[model samples]
Target: MNWIILILAGLFEVAFAFCLGKAKETTGNEMYFWYAGFLAALSISMGLLIKATQTLPIGTAYAVWTGIGAVGTVLVGIWVFKEPAGFLRLLFLTTLIGSIIGLKAVSSH
Candidate 1:
């Protein structure tokens, strides 16, 4: 389904963000490797997004895509990169998730 594709695309978006974060923390060959991973993930994410947009409304798809990426990246930051997970941060994340779900529920497709 297109929704599944969209979700995978969003996941890849998070993967690319993770690669960028890792690249930022490394050097030389390792850094280049991470950058390569970023490029690959970016390509795949974009491709899936384009595919999903064929059936899903562009606005809804894009918002959901970015929402998933934002939520996922933030969680990745907390778990992998040891970023802050304060109360306000989590509260906003929960809201973002709700918004994404609401968009999906309301979508005509």
Candidate 2:
């Protein structure tokens, strides 16, 4: 259950980051909407992280959450923003995922 919450929190982090990126180009009311969405997602994500930490070690939870966000952001950037999909970039993302899994496996939780 904690893992599930942590995963969703990470996804929210991704949403927050994406919204922030989009907000930069927006103006006035448009920017305000994106900013609000970003703030809401950020708050929810942080709340979930704090909750998950009650059951999971802070180090493990933080690393996993960041890993999820980073991977999601990279994938979203590639798919939605048409960013570069170079071989090296993908390889590093896979490596990061492997490290996240390794961390979880070794953790007491």
Candidate 3:
């Protein structure tokens, strides 16, 4: 269950990051709403990650969270915003995933 929660928290981290990217282009009243939402999601996700770290090693959990969030966000940015989707970008993303899994496995002991 903790792992599940941690994964969800990481997903939320990605979501908030996406929201921030969008909000960066805006500067009116609507921007504040997006900023507020981003802040709330970021804070809650970080708190959840901290709670999850009670059972998981900090390095392993943080790596997983950051890796997933960054990869997911970049993927979304490409699909949703038509950002660059080059082979090198995907290769690096794959490497991030591999390293995250390796770190988690090694730290699980």
On lDDT, the leading prediction is 1
Q: List the residue pairs that clash in candidate 2.
A: none
lDDT of 2: 0.94
| lDDT, candidates in the order shown | 0.99, 0.94, 0.85
- Write model 2 residue lDDT over 3-100, tens digit each, in one string: 99999999999999899978987899999999999999999999999999999999999999999999999998899788999999999999999998
Error of 2 at 38 (Å): 0.5
Tens digits of lDDT, candidate 3, 34-82: 8998998899899889888889878778888888798889888998778
2 or 3: which has the higher TM-score? 2
The residue pairs found clashing in candidate 3 are none
Candidate 1 positional error at 79, Å: 0.2
Q: Which model is ahead, 1 or 2, in terms of TM-score? A: 1
Question: What's the distance in Å from true for residue 77, model 1?
Answer: 0.1
**Model 2 misplaced regions, further than 4 Å:** none
Would you estimate the TM-scores of all the predictions? Answer: 0.99, 0.95, 0.89
73, model 2: CA deviation in Å? Answer: 0.8
Displacement of the residue 46 alpha carbon in candidate 1, Å: 0.2
Which order, best to worst by TM-score?
A: 1, 2, 3
